[model samples]
Target: MKDLYARHRAVLPDWLALYYDEPIELTHGEGRHVWDAAGRRYLDFFGGILTTMTAHALPDVTKAVAEQAGRIIHSSTLYLNRPMVDLAERIAALSGIPDARVFFTTSGTEANDTALLLATAHRRSNQILAMRNSYHGRSFTTVGITGNQSWSPTSLSPLQTLYVHGGVRSRGPYAALDDAEFTAACVADLRDMLGQSRGGVAALIAEPVQGVGGFTSPPDGLYAAFREVLAEHGILWIADEVQTGWGRTGDHFWGWQAHAAAGPPDLLTFAKGIGNGMSIGGVVGRAEIMNSLDANSISTFGGSPVTMAAGLANLSYLLEHDLQGNARRVGGLLIERLRAICAQLPVVREVRGRGLMIGIELVRPGTDEAYPQAAAAVLEAAREGGLLIGKGGGHSTSVLRVAPPLSLTVAEAEEGAAILERALRSV
Candidate 1:
């Protein structure tokens, strides 16, 4: 393996150094555990950054992908494919948007990029309003909407901003405003920005619960208010559900449902768990916005039969088993346990999130020392204790993210939380 890494390093470009590669070579996974090349098993609490809604090597998804591969594989967008249409209809029905249309992509980034483009085209605007600390995707346009400055880098030319503000959180300065006040301020800011741009604001994009932005759930009524403001301004609301969709949040099939918003977004993007770890993503939007794009706005690999089959199977299994309820139950248990743990640790500032998507924000008790290093140590200690977790947020600060597969059992949840507790103690 060392020799293999050396050989690959010799061929790989230096630009790949941006990634933090783990030392282990993973072979396979099942349920909630993954085995490294040396055959050591680790409990997967991170769930591929919330992508594996079902689980790794899900039997149903695997069989579907296999069966689809044996049959037809690729079909041009010029012709309708059965799996693609079926998946689209399923998504539309599940989302309670009968008039919704689906546009497939190979990854979350592409789906978000498509959503942004469709919003701009349909609304005929050049400005966008995004929540600070929100993460849309890595594409140029999506990155512009993303609020994390580190992702843009110093050398990269900054995308011209429409507007951005911090998400609803207690730690930020924006926390002073109550939920309604914050929403109103956000709306007023957007209105001002749009007026400044002469009605050139295309959309207001946000995550139902900011995922990579530290799992920050918005204050109550915020999303609903934002939706109303967007409607007033004729701006599209784009929900970037790349990390929070596919029933991971537990209360509903999509994260936005947690907010109890009255109307659906003008556009919504989903990836990650849509195909149960397969490289499949999609943009679902109102028919008007979806149809605004030209006929050539599709990739050769997008909506391929294999990916469609995997998506269908994943969604089918989720619905048939009612895995969303399981996620809610198991995740509730984990959150309760986490809150109890946080109460005991001075470094832990707060615990926030819903369902399987959880975050533990760490702050120094007395001094200004942020505990990002402590968080990394906790993750390393968790790994040693047979659990795998991940971190997120700006500065890669301490936000211990727990996003296990929806199929996780109560026993697994207990074990993972125990590992986390032990990791916290060690740190």
Candidate 2:
């Protein structure tokens, strides 16, 4: 493992961060458990950043991929692709947008990039609105819109970007406000920013539950309030559901459903979970906005047959098993358990998040100041106790993220929670 780690550092970009001081090379996985190079099994809570929606090495998805691979795999968009069209149709129907259309990409970054292009072209504007402490993706265009300074590497961007004030309600100017008051304040801020724009703004893109921003979320209906204002200015709303999509949030099938008064966003971006670890990402939007691009564009590897098959199979399993309910029940118990445990731990500043997408914010024992070291220490300790978790937040990265597979069993949840409790106590 040490030799492999040294080789990884030698070849990979230094910016591509790896977790842990002694990184473990995951060999294989089954259900909610993954085995490392040393054949040590550990509970997988992060789900490869929530990409494995159903479970690891799901039989249905694996069989679909194998069958698809045997039949055919690589076909460009020029030819008629049944699996791609089939998956797109399903997504369009599932998406609430009127006259919805679907376009596939290989990753969240590309999906967001395409959404930006569509928004800019449709609205005939280069200006965009994003939320502070939010992370969209790592592409040059996505990095530009990302409000998280830690993930954003450069100031240069093709479009004019404006940061908004709603994404985080726990640690912002509006933190103290009640839910209704917070919504009003954020809406006022959005309108104020719109007034200050030089030209027309194309769209306002946001993550429903700010994923890399420690699963932080604004009050429900906040986006709906902003939607009302954006509609007045003819600005489109884009919901970045890369992490919060497909019932992972438990309460809502799509994160935007929490703010359903506005019907739905003009555009929605999704990735990570739908394919259950297959590389599949896409934008679902109204036909008018999606068809705004006069010129042709295509993703060479997007919506490949194998990936689409995996997505179809995985999505079927997710829906058939009603993993959303599982997430809701299991996650509720897990969060409550952690909250009960953390009540005695002063280093835990807050336990926040919905469904399986939970975050534990670490702080100094006496101060509200973020204690990233404590988070790191807890993470290491969790691994030592045979559980794998993840961490992310603002610049400080002080939140411990726990988003296990949506199909997590109650027993597994209890086991993982006990381990996490021990780890936290140790830290």
Q: Pick the candidate with the highest TM-score.
A: 2
The reply for model 2, stretches above 4 Å from the true place, is: none
Predictions in order: lDDT: 0.80, 0.93
Alpha-carbon TM-score of each model against the true structure: 0.93, 0.99
How many residue-pair clashes does candidate 2 contain? 0
For model 2, name the residue pairs that clash.
none
List CA RMSD, all candidates: 2.2, 0.7
Tens digits of lDDT, candidate 1, 151-243: 554324233456455374665656778777776776666566666765457888889888777798767557777677667767788888898
Model 1, residue 397: distance off in Å is 3.5
lDDT of 2 by residue, 234-280 (tens): 99999999999999888999999999998899999999999999999
Count of backbone clashes, every candidate in sequence: 1, 0
